[model samples]
Target: MGNTESVVVQKRLTRFRPEERPVIEGVFDRLQGGAGGPSGAPGKTPAGKTLTLEMLQSSMGSLAPDSMVRRIYQCMCRIDPGMAAPAASGKTSTPTASGVGREQLVIFLADTMRGTAEERAPLVLAMSQHGAGAAAVVTCEQVAEFLQDLISAVVQILVHRGRLQAWKPEKMGDGSLGVKLLAEQMCSELKPSDQGACDVSCLEDWIFRVSQVSLYLEMLVAEGLNVSLSSRLAPTLLPPCRETPWKELRCLLDLPVLMFLAPQLPDSYNAPWRLVFSTQLHGESFTRVVTGLTNCGPTLLLIKDTKGHVFGGFASHAWEVKPQFQGDSRCFLFTVFPRLRVYTATGYNQHFMYLNHSQQTMPNGLGMGGQHGYFGLWLDSEFGRGHSRARPKCTTYGSPQLSGEEDFTLDSMEVWAVGKPPEPEEGEEGQGKRSVLHMDPEVQAIMEMTGKTLHSQGFREPEEDQE
Candidate 1:
């Protein structure tokens, strides 16, 4: 009997450490008959089972609701000494209805945002149950703005670190480098006049100038021209003949060419650059005059009608020629537009310019004296809207609610660049590609479970977590 008693004492000692004694004693004090006589003292209990009663009370309080409920059966073994079966295998009763305040909702949302995916799920679920779910409150516009700010911050960080690619002198030439550097510096120095919304209009102009400079540099690089010398000699290349009729006409037709060649023209009329002209007599005895010159190579002149019908040929030799045409006497205009395709090897850009005598009275008309004539020379890629897609809309919330309505809630917003899709397999069969839109299955499951638990706790979804 002594040996058996010793074993029992050892087991009881192993069940709880000395530090846990106060907690056990506290639970017993709360459960026993309030501080009064026989009913309160442990020693006066019937069958001398006060120790067992105290253990049971402590055990129930210690069992975490998050853990599997079945474990409570094992805990009861030490608490209820004479019990043959375990307590009910289920969750505790839900909390009573008590409305959470707005400040409390916000705090809850902040906490949820900091929590793990598992911890957050229940909070989201509770919010949904309370009708103050994410969908009912948060707005898509707010989400978009948040995303934009996030992206801008990330881009700024990357640019500061110098991880982004810069213009390569060897590949883009000295002229290109100078232009790009100037643009970058200008952008860095310019401060927005207003702190309203993000305005990218100023950046558009900078982009156009950069494109022009880059194209010019690329052309020189293709011809193996030394940019340093070319830049120095730019002003001296053009002659005083800039006032000449033909020169003016060419400038009107191609504005970009004029801007690009302006710095390279010579002060005097050395006429180092060749000039050529050709006129063809058509079937109606009308003269189709073509006048242009190029320092690079042979220029291909193509004249097309309103119906996209071509009628011109390449001028290999400078000689007067005649052509035949069956069309009526229609006003034919010479115009140019940038080629849709890019030629990196030749550094030849497809640019367009147009002249329409018929639309002389239109709001945007063409003339020799007006600014419209130099269209091609001033044509820039940056002046218009850049490439971008429309973003989807989202909802917003001003406060948290307790009505069952939405699927989820968000506390903080994050934006990420779209990455390249994975390459397709060469030989795999019956395999499907993954989509960027959907969340992972494991994440969904965890969120679902979290929501259920939070709902049971009678907590409404937090407000700050709404998108």
Candidate 2:
């Protein structure tokens, strides 16, 4: 920034009173629900003059130049919550419901003003360059719109260097989608979020929304759950629905990455990441609710055992109950509450973890092991819970495995799907490749007794590649 501009920014920064300074680590700490603080008090930082540039950088978890800018942006939002374009003069619409209080500001910081320094610099510059006398009401959207126009050249750099190409299904061959994105379109595909129940009236409200989303993602990573967020790291897409289960466990929604799915979805397709999906539904009613769940895509399945312990799997594909096997490698079992432990696909011991119907015969149910089966976990067609037993196959996950020999019955089943399910246009690529092909266990047993190979209709082994 020029000398005049720097002086202007400093003056604006000092506008807020010392009493308003945060006592703790800014808004992020508060969102953590006081996870770490003196006396476990809510994260309200003390009002102080220490929010200088150096202090801001030190507070940043990421040291990138852009990350530093983001830190400054956070400080500005907190210290100058009043800085903004004014609410409209006409109809007094209610503020966005979710954005009504503190949480709204957090989301604005995390989403709208996020990305690299180049992405957020214009907003900072706009605020700094504005003459103090004018003090125009600067909405976050207005700043964003201004940046798009002024930085068209920067965006053009991407156009000259990159071009769109059709995506094919495969395991991420090391993040080689062969392209670099323009700044403007980086998060372009995520659906334009519903402005909650109402529209944001002023600037500070936008900042809070950004702040909230940023804190949530950072917390997710700090807790050690895997999430793909960086532009360079993380595959564009995991193996398709057939080859693998989950699309990709991305922490933040990125348009370039999401558009790689087969059926191209809308720019406003992002929603699942904004909220917590902890609702419970029953097995009997599950099928009915499954389609609607496509909006909140893949989900977590929790089964409460008769012993009062809860265990379940992550359904990599959307919940669709057909008379056959669906889903892929992304599906894995997990346990929440009494300590979190996730058991991923061993690839080797996959015979039992897959979903199937006709092959089992008798009662159409999930397949555990072939012919010599081990009913490690089972949920009946009824809405009630099923059974879980200890299993040798799940040993790699440590401790006593899920299923037991005594046929432990479960008490309840709860499911949670995140985001909207991939659209039919977005393409499920490898899912839904099989259907009811298993005969009754009795008839199959008799056929096996008479020396018959149990092959589901249309089941064919692929030919080996010729050298």
Candidate 3:
């Protein structure tokens, strides 16, 4: 980095906090042969103010693979052509430039972490090019491959950092398939040309349309590169888990699906995911499913059809076993396999959620969206048969048929209670009967800190307190 570039980089560094600026600069210095090796091992340093691809890969640690690191370097070179080591003249070339400078590194970090969709779109395009030489457009296959690598990096980061929140990978379904499906689903958002090639405009449009693209990229950069960011800049990617027997659990959802769906839930940023029901554990009975689902708060119901389609719905409120429609517009229909897309209420009708059983006159089943016999998702009281029917689309949610078949056979299902359970009703038992001091120790700690009277501690019976 020359004096001119140094001044420019420092000016841009002001965008970060005073304390954080040094960390970003430290990465630049380390890559430019400052003091120690990538892993802090003492070694002879190279002489240059530039970051070679080797240095970038070494600095990225063992978590990130060569593919991701190469993309990062290519994106950096695209950001500043001057930083790229001189290439042979007149030959088609990969942006496998020898190195990039301090300015390019700083800008890459800034755009990935803080810039808007437009600013990051070019980086995505550059990365998606892979090893294509002088290719002006990227095919859909290329983009999907890029996203697969990107998502793979996110998963590795989560696993390597022990950030799974007690989720055991072995207890779940094939996560690699989930990763591939998610990548394809993300790629579906792009409007490619007749040749199935996506230009920069198509990519920019995708980045603007799908908010998840930016989020995944931001997570990859922040986590894969081990960058420290403020809480506001980098919110928790996965929700914490309430104490549950995670080891014994078998789930239909893998980490990739969880990563895709967790951020979509409203107001659940810090909420813990609680397992409410699973056919595998609780048995294949509708009564058991209902028993597990009722009054368990907002839940995500995932179902895999016999034909291998994974889809479900988000019930915004506690499911009451009644014939009448129950739930507001917050409820929605979503698909996980084949493609991942969410359909919210259109307000065309109030047919959001319905659940009933053991009734002779009324239809006894669980359904969400659309009308009777033409529901967007309907699970029969028979326990194994369900249908996701839509003539054109569901009146309420405007969603297409969710299951693989109009009437599909159930393969497996699970319900996850997201966010905190609704407050206990008056005179309710079990968890509801517990007092605030018992339920939340944070409240008790605050009272003690403020020198408040511990009346509950003194007056409450020992058994009640313990409960």
How do all models score by TM-score? 0.17, 0.31, 0.83
Specify the poorest-scoring 10-residue window by lDDT in model 2: 91-100
Error of 3 at 293 (Å): 1.1
Off by over 4 Å in 1: 1-243, 246-252, 258-304, 307-314, 320-335, 338-467
Clashing pairs in 3: none
Using lDDT as the measure, the top candidate is 3
lDDT score of residue 371 within candidate 2: 18
Q: Each prediction's Cα lDDT score?
A: 0.23, 0.34, 0.76
Shift in Å, residue 152, candidate 3:
1.0
Q: Decide which is better by TM-score, 2 or 3.
A: 3
Report the Cα lDDT for candidate 2: 0.34
1 against 3, candidate with superior lDDT: 3
| lDDT per residue (tens digit) for residues 197-225 in model 2 | 21222333333333322322233222211
Error of 1 at 358 (Å): 30
Cα deviation of 119 in candidate 2 (Å)?
A: 30
Q: Quote the positional error of residue 73 for candidate 2 in Å.
A: 26
In angstroms, how far off is 99's CA in candidate 1?
54
* C-alpha RMSD by candidate, in order: 34.1, 20.9, 8.2
CA lDDT of 109 in candidate 2? 40
lDDT per residue for candidate 3 within 114-204, as digits (tens), equals 7777667767877877563435677899889889888888887788888888777788778899889889888878999998988767887
